[model samples]
Target: MTATPRAVDAKEILLTWLTDQVSVPVVSTRPDNKDAPATFVRLLLTGGTGRHDRALHTTQLTIDSYAPTTAAAVELALAVDAAVHGAVAGLSPVVRVSGTSPSESPDPDTTSARATATYQITTRLLT
Candidate 1:
């Protein structure tokens, strides 16, 4: 009943936290992968009530590779997602990733050699 508003508020709070993400370093040495260090992350989280008892939380996060190539953008996204999942796992209130659809947007500065992109992530939160 009253939990509906609470859920929306919680979603907003999480959205705010994600949109203003900070850059973190990458330390992966996989032979087939050269992870690109993250530069920045922006999230556009939006969602509300849904069918049945299921609630949804959708977030569109963006990342900048600084000077890496398209390949780098992917590694950065992984690191960012890992960091995000960890933080959410330790959230005060319990929440889970019911479903997730992550995609990478084309580079903004196509002319530049540096790689940069925005990730659109749709995450459903079932209450």
Candidate 2:
């Protein structure tokens, strides 16, 4: 008898990877810090797919880079893009990583400038 392949937590994997690679704090949700830094990255898992017969998983994520200024936000978004691509070799399970160009997306609630980008990460799950 053969055992079914296990599903991986794509969000956790990405959060862990980005936290280590990025200079700024990487969080899944808005920080509760009373004195939050001027720059930070927030990650949201938009969607994903997996097969029962295979250990391969693909996850889509939205990355929001926030800063005090629009220029700073854009710079941070670019840095994040580089860091995400750099993970392809370092992350064992990750098979590929792709992303769209970061665009300006100012936040409605705050005066902080924001940049947004989408990424697709494909990983091979361990049995």
Candidate 3:
């Protein structure tokens, strides 16, 4: 008998991975604290796709790197890109990772500088 496939929480998997791999704090949303760390990473699930006949899922994630300076933010973004690509071999659920739209920009509402990148990740669903 074939087992049923289950939905994969890509955000949680990545959060755990980035938290262990990156130097800065990794969060799904911006911290509510007024004194939040100057350097941090935020992960957002933009969109995804799932195959009806296959136990495979693809997700689009936007990663925002925030720091005190634009250059620092950009550097952090690059680091995140590298980390995500480098660690794929160890992450079983993750089958592929493709990145795009790396840019350096500052947050408008806050003083922190922001750099952004989008990654398309394909994963094998657990059954």
Q: Which candidate is the best by TM-score?
A: 3
What's the lDDT for all of these models? Answer: 0.41, 0.84, 0.86
Positional deviation of residue 66's Cα in model 2 after best superposition, in angstroms: 0.6
**lDDT preference between candidates 2 and 3, better one:** 3
Ranking by TM-score: 3, 2, 1
TM for candidate 2 is 0.89
For candidate 1, the 10 contiguous residues with the lowest summed lDDT are 25-34
Return the clash pairs for model 3, or none: none
lDDT per residue as tens, model 3, 1-127: 9888886888889999999888999999988587799899999999966553477788889999999889899999998998888657978888889888569866777888999999988888888
All candidates: CA RMSD (Å):
9.2, 1.8, 1.6
Of 2 and 3, the candidate ranking higher by TM-score: 3
lDDT tens digits by residue: candidate 2, 1-127: 8666665676788788878887888888866467877789999989865553366778889999999899999999999898888878887788888879999998897778999999988888666
**Candidate 3: residue 32 Cα off by (Å):** 3.8
